[model samples]
Target: MQAILQSSDTELDIVRALRENCERPFEDAHAMPPAVYTSEAFLALERRDVFRTEWLCVGRASALANCGDYLSAQIDDQPVFVLRDASGALRAFSNVCLHRMSVLLEGRGNVRRIVCPYHAWNYTLDGSLAAAPLMDRQPGFCKEQYKLPAVRCETWQGWIYVTLNEHAPAVESHLSELSKLIEPYGMGDYVETFHEEHVWDTNWKILAENFMESYHLPMLHRATVGPHSRLEEMECPPGSPAFNYHWITKEASLPIGNAHPTNTRLEGHWRRTTALLAIYPTHLVTLTPGYFWYLILQPQGVGRVHIRFGGGLAPEFVDDPQAAGYMATLKTLLDEVNAEDRRGVEAVFRGVHAPLAKPGHLSPLERPNYDFARYLAGRLGAT
Candidate 1:
């Protein structure tokens, strides 16, 4: 095993400086200290205070619609798997086996029982110990006491969320107000059509901050989204406890297949707008008239993040005869935008690590960046 990184007073000083900067007014606020981005010590602090304790969005619950469907992932280094049990309920369990601590599952699959590759000890879909061959001779062994451990799991608006914190609030209670803001989009009725995972070579915060604001659209995405975006038309409301959203309104330039059959209830601006929101800690999403896309971020270390990227169209679009053909165009567009973002943010990561790097003033357009910084500061101070 690799040796654990230890924090020194110098690192704590960096954390203190970042907290101070986060408390500054938006006009006076600067970015977080460079150390906060490049230091493993600081990442450790965030893992303990933020990632481990906060409710994290994993994926859409609809993805695991069948009884035996399951998705496996690492939540802050804790091997975990979420499955739909025989009763058709979503469940999450430590992917680690009880016998010799072997990981019980990998990626996504449909399994009747989870069997450990190292030892044949198996667990049922509901996380109960099912079988342990050749263990009858053990003096005090008891299968009942060896069932796989469960972690807290919840679903809200068809999205799956899991938290390692035992005392965390219910996902719905935290997101109820945000639901009101998104109800107009009929987000719940949208079916996921594309899902992919990629590991980015940049700090998680860099990408998180990048996705939360559109200030870069005019420059970073010049070849694609730039021409369509007008920074002056953006409306970033004040940050709230659950999430922060900003609107970007622009008329459709080119029709891919069909106009998004948006709800008539949505008015003028809503008809041509996209709301980009960051649900604090990690879940970042964008809701548009015809479709939605989301990014579920998992920090692998100070320099890497595992991203769960997914997008889907409204029920109307899904029912369209050309749905498949339209989705092909949509996926291509998303991939191009993602590539543009990847290049931009990775460049920022390199700059952040330079010896002369320092926090710079933030633009008003980067309100989400400010909100994200405050959220990180709050997490650092909690507990």
Candidate 2:
């Protein structure tokens, strides 16, 4: 472990800064240093120590409802894809072609076969090499011998997670406590009505930390959701090993932001409460009574992040006569919120590059950010 994390001096400096942050008391803890986000060496360390070893969420399983629908993604440089097979079971595998190493798929869509563009070689929905054109003419080139490598794909409460580490703990087992706490929201049943992919100019950790804290909601989002976010109404308890969370009661601009009238699981003020969850490295979910939305982050080097953004109505709101209206309102609000966040996170990325840039002290509202910093440090720290 030390050899992996301590491979380079620059990375060692960044990890030391992170450990220093973790060593402080709650009131005294500061933000992690800028190098954690800007250092290529440190990003390389995370590529090995964090992304390769964690259960990274791709998107919601609801987005891949039909057979052959697949989501393509990467961990470090290893390209992978996850799809719902013809048998209706979800599976993931290397996206690279076995013939000439072309990526079998690009982006998400329904397909009859995973065809390589470089060559005509194709694969079944289950990742079996279905056809390798003209390969039969070659000696001893069995199609079975060229099947795409399998990867571990797991569904945790409707979210699709894939990991390169076969020895990693089960997704369900890792988030069991979080499941119990968020059970009343019926998160697994919310069908995703919208899914999108975008690349943003910001460090992935900066974006992850942005989603982890609501301290800036009243100011950064003042033109949008800021007015509804009252700091006093928020709750940030100590985070657990696998994740961190915070909650706030919202006076919604969209009715769907609150619990639907048909919702019975939530009573009183619980209907207007929203739970913000940071599941380990990169899965951030805003689970509300009437709807839910999430961001699955993937780092593109040290300065850019590839984001899978999506959301949908809760089970109660999905069946309402006004479901279309709710979906429209939710999408509009999300677009606005994302625009605001994009501006904010991108600015922070620029600021981090300044010569005097350094992490500052944290507020109580930034507890989740503190926890997230520690999570990053813990992952890249030496044994």
lDDT of 1 by residue, 257-323 (tens): 2236545646666777777889988898887777778998999888898999998877777777876
What TM-score fits each model? 0.94, 0.96
TM-score, prediction 1:
0.94
TM-score for candidate 2, please give it: 0.96
Off by over 4 Å in 1: 1-8, 254-259, 262-267
**CA displacement after TM-score superposition, residue 313 of candidate 2 (Å):** 1.0
Best by TM-score: 2
Instruction: Indicate the residue-level lDDT of 25 in model 1.
Output: 88
